[model samples]
Target: MYERLDKLRAEVERCKRKVEDDRQRLKAAEQKLQEAENTQILADVGALNLSPEQLADFLKLVANGQVGSAGTVSTVTAVNKETEVETKDDDDYDLEGLEDEEN
Candidate 1:
């Protein structure tokens, strides 16, 4: 009888360990799936030509359930501002000085 009780206890322990391992595997699989989904989303967003700031706003809208029927006005405005700044920066460089230095 004691031997039978010991065997049953060992079986119960084994079952518990197996359940825990399966739970761990399930958790890992879920994490992997989430990472893959995020990667796909990033790729799709890149294809849309959104800047980093626009992308952040887009993600925020999606997360807040406010993405429906939103226009591209904000993103376009942000990109335009960035372009203006970049153009101004390029204009600030002294091209004549660069030519003189090379000569």
Candidate 2:
């Protein structure tokens, strides 16, 4: 009877520890899921490239159903800036130390 009682107590303790571990893993997974969702939302918002005031106004207009047709929504133009090209050539170095071997 004592042996059976000891086995039951050990099993309960093991189950408790397992449950705690599972809870921690679950919490981490939930945090990762939330972060991923936030990343997706930020990516979508970033793609819009709207300033804070413009985004807020656009969102408010959309929420209020103010923009009904294509004419009502203002046109947003994307500005393209000229970027400077990197002209550093790493493979063009002159090797001055090596002597030519005559075979």
Per lDDT, the best of the predicted structures is: 1
- Give the distance in Å from residue 46's predicted Cα in candidate 1 to where it truly belongs: 0.9
Q: lDDT of all the models against the reference?
A: 0.68, 0.66
lDDT of each residue in 3-103, candidate 1, tens digit only: 99999999999999999999999999999999999999888878978677766765666677644343322212223345421112344556997889999
TM-score (C-alpha) between model 1 and the true structure:
0.54
- Residues 71-101 of candidate 2 have per-residue lDDT tens digits of 4433333222432212222344554544344
**Per-model TM-score on C-alpha atoms:** 0.54, 0.58
Which runs in model 2 stand beyond 4 Å of their true positions? 62-103
Error of 2 at 65 (Å): 5.6
Error of 2 at 8 (Å): 0.8
Alpha carbon lDDT at 26, candidate 2: 100
